[model samples]
Target: MILSVQNYGQNKSIAKDKIKVLENTAQESIFVHYNSSLFMVGEYMYYKIYCLNSETNKLSHISKIAYLELVDKEGERVFKQKIRLDNGFGQGDFFLPVDTRSGNYKLVAYTKWMSNWGQEIFFSDDVIILNPYSNNQRDFLESEVSKEDLQSKSDLRPSNSALSELNKSPLQLFISKKNYGKRDEVIMEFEGINSKKIPDGEYSISVRKYSPVFPNQKKTTVDHLESKEISPPTFDNNITLPELRGELVTGRVVAKSTDIPLENLKIAFSVPGEDYQLKIARTDVLGQFHANITKPYRSEEILIQLIDDNVDGLTIELDDFASPFNSDKVKFESFRLNPEMNDLILKRSIQNQIENAYFKVKPDTITSNVNELNFYGTKGITYLLDDYTRFPTIKETVLEILDNVWLTENKNDKYVFNLRTLNGEFNNSEFTSLLIVDGLFVKDQDYFINNFSSNSIEQINIVKEYYRMGSQIFDGIIDIKTFDQNYAALASKNDMTALKLNRQTEIKNYFRQSYGNESSKDLERIPDLRQQLLWLPNFEIDDTQRITFFTSDLKGDFEISIEGFTHTGKPVSILDTITVE
Candidate 1:
């Protein structure tokens, strides 16, 4: 609900008294390193995001979340992704669909903290996408290239095995040979140039075929450091806070009938999964609340609800997923598709189709590296329902099968539960114990006790010790595991709100083509028509740093580029060419 002017003024005063307003001193900027500026249908656009401190030119630790968007010429968003940052670095990839129109699109990246200043601090680069399957190419192929334009582009092309140095790069890239055949192993070494000391840092490397139709779209590290100067924003009461801990989800609450802001209400946020997380936050004086999700969750949806008895009178509203920055300021480049690129585009499109058909044999793995512990502690007494005698209702099941847990009804016809302590007794406290079903919080005790039974539940866990979440304290815990683990089906939908969260992008182990191993026999029948041989978004430079990869079956001059920052915050950008004959 939109707050009135008087309410907003009171909120600002309360915010000033409660929160410490931080000045925009250490401003942040983003620089994205992408694999290619040109793409076709079924091809993936790989990119790495570098969140840097503008003043120091080093990695910024201010924000843990970054946003990447693909904006079209009309300032419309084609796709948007929310990426999780690790030490000011993050990587993600998107596959171009066959239905995408051929045009020049802008790839934009920025953090929440960077959005406060404006679009000037955002990292934006023009990209060309060609779709042979679609006929909508008016924006790109409206006019033919002039004879002088073609000559100018051809004259600027680099020779074979040429190296383009940027900012007098300290590191040197070495290759074993200038030319190689298909499926040949290529080893590259990176070291200090002229005995110069190479500062330690993280870097990314990409080896892709150089297509003549594409322009010079690669951005040097020095260009960003020199161009993006941080201008501290003027002090304002409504500044966007940096996500110092984790992904921050902010929203407001208001009365359903009067549309008035509801303040100081406790809200529960649940990310339901096998390894779920439960957090609680209270709305401020302005009816706005922020919850920080520090842990990783597999579920793509989350539940948010008020934790009070008068939840039905309030409406919980969440902020929109669209970026707050204005997209009209983005300047797009005109893409003139030359007539000579027809055959090349057809060849690449066919190769992409062939490679995608055999994607099952060459699969990428989605990582599932998360903590196994549940939100509640692991030390709890678990009772398997199948081991006990069959019971009709949960009330009977708890009394007969369970040991130290007791469930009874009060005079108001509401069910209550308590955990027995070591003295073979329990306290008669007025506070209610926490109840969970399939990792979801169930506030209505009568609904769970009357609806759920031994037939639907698989097991029950009881924790006798007191557990605390946010400002609410529970006397004990009674976590019920459902047979289907269907929290949505069993959860009380009276006052709860479910939202589809833009969860962290899944990190994939990109399919690597290797001809030296025994598994190569399986890939012999599969057509190896790969234009981009290798894309390492996170490349480590160890003590004996050596990078190796095999060239694809496609013959061309591949561009090998490395972009990153050193420990001393110095930018690093190096480019070299290798021909595969």
Candidate 2:
């Protein structure tokens, strides 16, 4: 929220107003609760993000998008994704790829609004990865160890978390039993020590087998609450606005000839696909324009163009979404692989391979109920092409099958589509009808009329009433749907500038296994080598709630962790252990 002002006289007043606005804005912080700090090559790393108001420590409603990234020891991004936040909560997961080498890594999470403070206030955690298949184990091995010493020397031991003298969390975990057989159902309950301090909040539950190889101390909700009380660093005159609406797409418009910024220009942008969106933005005093995409679009690229009749040889340049912050400042701790852990590593590797081999039988499903709505509301007259006789050309099909719609030339001698009133009145309005093809804006009506075949079109929609978007109004709308849905091929590359956009990450429904079912009986022969019994990345905790999940075939001690912030912004961290015989 800091802005550097170069000209003290011209922009002096504007700078003061901007600084006043930022000073009133509250800062934000993030907390990420992850399943485990240690992982094998084939395991999935699940996490949940909680955005908080730095002052109140409650869920912040300022930002709608958050980013999560996994960085290596050298600070290069290994994986990054855009998460669509819903009321300050989001969840995602990543599977460890086989090609990833064994090393110590870090997971960082932050919202673009949090960037105003700096990367130091961002949420970060250490992660240790073990890869037995790759030869990149040099970092985890002794430099002078001999070949014989690497096989059976018993010096290597797993790292353990040091016991702390801090006060325990008020939240306690209640389980029905301490031990159970494989595939047995276990129910865990949550309750607070005092009735007034009941644990009620949005929490994440993870039941993972304790990693005995390279386990690192996992930070809890309380730890984050204590460490995240930092304030915004002193501003050196750099400012970034918060994305209050949605994903913010920003750029600058400049004159093509002199490379000078052009101010007060209007730009029309469109994201083309089934869920395409159209938006309008205007350049400010700095020649920069900001547009917020309110919803998720299917297109990987966007089209932007000047809305004016004469663009005056102006061009647009989009800013990259990559963060400018340098992540190379992070330091990693050393974790050496000892020969004593070789037997345990081999067993886990074999189990992972077996579980992957039968993965096709039990695959995760994508929970997609994306409510697709027409960019324009649902009040247009639709036509089904198959209901009538087949026509060869678009002009003939529209003339014969359509009603109250026709193509005519405008004052500029350009062909444009016009819609008449349903009462058969010839509309002589000043505004032209908006033409669209497969969710893409079509400017040149002549080109589409002559080149597009009726055989390629599936349906046509006509709206006789005037339509408005932003400050622009159209007399009517002519929306056409093509069979192939390939709007990119029809888009006029001459008038539009194509730029890549970083869209929100897709949501998925994690696979869950249950016993005593018909499908479970059929897969009884397949080995159940799952180490992590259950993972709920977004679990809502009530006053006294019960959770039920069946244990896996893997027999060992599993850690149950519930970490999050309560409705009143109080930190709740509870831990317990269960043994599966």
Candidate 3:
């Protein structure tokens, strides 16, 4: 039943060209045609075959023997035929005949070396793909923008070098000899780049996360060198912006009827599975604020919380305005001040002022957690521990409920704890503690079990792994008091610096105490400069006999104002030695 055409050609012995072929083996009458134009997708159809040069193996410069065949689904060779080709891999046509009623078929028509093996049977896509290319891109905006400038020197500061700077997360880009043109030390200087005129959409900010190795100069010949050194975390975040890059955000506040714009208002949006929240922004004069944040492949919805401690502590202001807000005094009218329409007036009545405060909280996530809770002035934090997970202890034969797990830290010297806004005394006390110590969450105010005895804590699973760890992941030393054996370590460092003294460092410290009132332009104040000896290993002045210190600008020259102190830590003698070297 196999159709043969090799013996039927008019010039069978001398036929040196290839032919085209087609087949039908499906339920529905399948149409086989090359819809090539960009045209009606259904117009560029007819019938053709390939005539390969046989010398080269491609349709472009080789030989081809093409044919069309119509066979039954069971491998029965029904009809074998041939067609011609006018163009290569372009618009053309071929037809097939079927005997079956209706079902499905795979009509594959391919040349010996064709790139895109064309298929006639269309089975369109029907599955979801999760490859990198398949995922949606993240949004560049819609994130928090800190008011601080970041640095590459310290990971803590807001600088271009810090990995935590905006837009640097999620994706990391590097320039290396391995990837780029064999170059090392790729120094990108943005001394004249401006971002003010750029539109507000997202753009891929490129930066070199890694540089190449150092160059090596061998004997006579120059070989490729790689030192693999890392620069301190600095932000190519461009160091400075033309201004506090801003945008507009719209919102309304009813209870505090004052038309004054909320100042220093912080808004945070956290995408799930993300390392950090977007950013915290400050409000303008009219309680209006806008934060500039970016996220690639942004999440659909983000978690947002508005906070301002000076104007009002999150829960504190919410508490003070509770009664008035609930009553008619804090009524929210329409837009304007129409007496008949009664647009809610911003009340200036309550004056419970807040000194300092912060919010690192989230909304309640447990059913037992309070439904509606209020905090004054400060913005509401949404993330909180609201669950009691019951676990069985191996040593103790009883079920224990674990509840009120919270985050703790310290600011200055005071401690803070971000607790769930539950209708409980302990947690409320914790919120009060946050106001006193700025944004710190400390150990004392940590949310704990309600009725469980301290002895019942057979296995307290301190979630240390969940925190950014170090000497104080909890942000404060909870286990040991300031100075005993543990103080041994801190005391050792102080004592060690207490070792060698460079006459220069000794003089600098002394001058600062006399001037600047012991204040520093950096994040902290300069140490009391006047309290040091010239010959000590600790003060780090163990340099030379001739000490030289100079004051900035019009402050005057560097004078080694030497002074002696008694055992009681009081100044005994003042020796003013003005050295030249």
Q: Please give the RMSD to the true structure for each candidate, in Å.
A: 3.6, 5.2, 38.5
Model number with the top lDDT: 1
Once fitted onto the true fold, the runs of candidate 1 whose alpha carbons sit more than 4 angstroms away are: 1-14, 17-21, 149-164, 193-199, 256-261, 386-392, 422-424, 541-543
TM-score of each: 0.91, 0.88, 0.18
Could you tell which candidate, 2 or 3, scores higher by TM-score? 2
Q: How many steric overlaps are in each model, in order?
A: 0, 5, 97
Lowest lDDT sum, 10 consecutive residues, model 1, at 1-10
* Predicted candidate 2 versus true structure: per-residue lDDT over 1-581, tens digit per residue: 01121211111112766777876778888898888887889888888889988888788889989999888777677678788888888888888998888887888888876776778888888787888889878767646655554432222222233112112455656798899998898888766657545556677888877744445367777778778756754454545667889887776765656655466677777787776777878887776777888887668877777766666666566666566346687676455676667888998899999998988887887666577768777878899898899898878987899999888877788777888976779999888788888777776777788878889888898888888866668888888888888866676676776776666776666667778888788667778888777888777545456778888889988888777787778777766778999
**lDDT scores for all predictions?**
0.77, 0.75, 0.21
Residue-level lDDT tens digits of model 3 in 1-581: 01111221111111122111111101110112211111111111122222221222122212121233322233333323322222221112222222221211122233322211112211111111011111231211123333231111112212243213322212122212122211112211111013312112111111111001111101100000011121221212111110112111123222243554454444432222111113344444433333332222112323334433333322111101000001111211111111321111111001001100100111112112122312121233221122334333311211233233343344543333333333432343312322111111112232221222233222222221112221112211111111111221222121011111111000011111112223333312322111111211011122221222222211111112111111221211111212111
Model 2 score (lDDT): 0.75
Error of 1 at 92 (Å): 1.1
Better of 1 and 2 by TM-score: 1
lDDT of each residue in 1-581, candidate 1, tens digit only: 12221222111222564334456347899988998877887999898899988888889888898999988877777779888888899888988888787888888899877876777888888787888888788887677777777555433444343344473566777798989999999998878765744557768888988766566566667678878876776436666667888888777777866655577788888777667678889887767787888776778777776777756556666765457556577677766777778898888888888888988898888877756666676867899888888898988988898888888777677987877865668767676788887778787778888887668888888887778888888888888888788866567787576777777887778888888689898887668988788888887655676788898789989988788898668888887778989
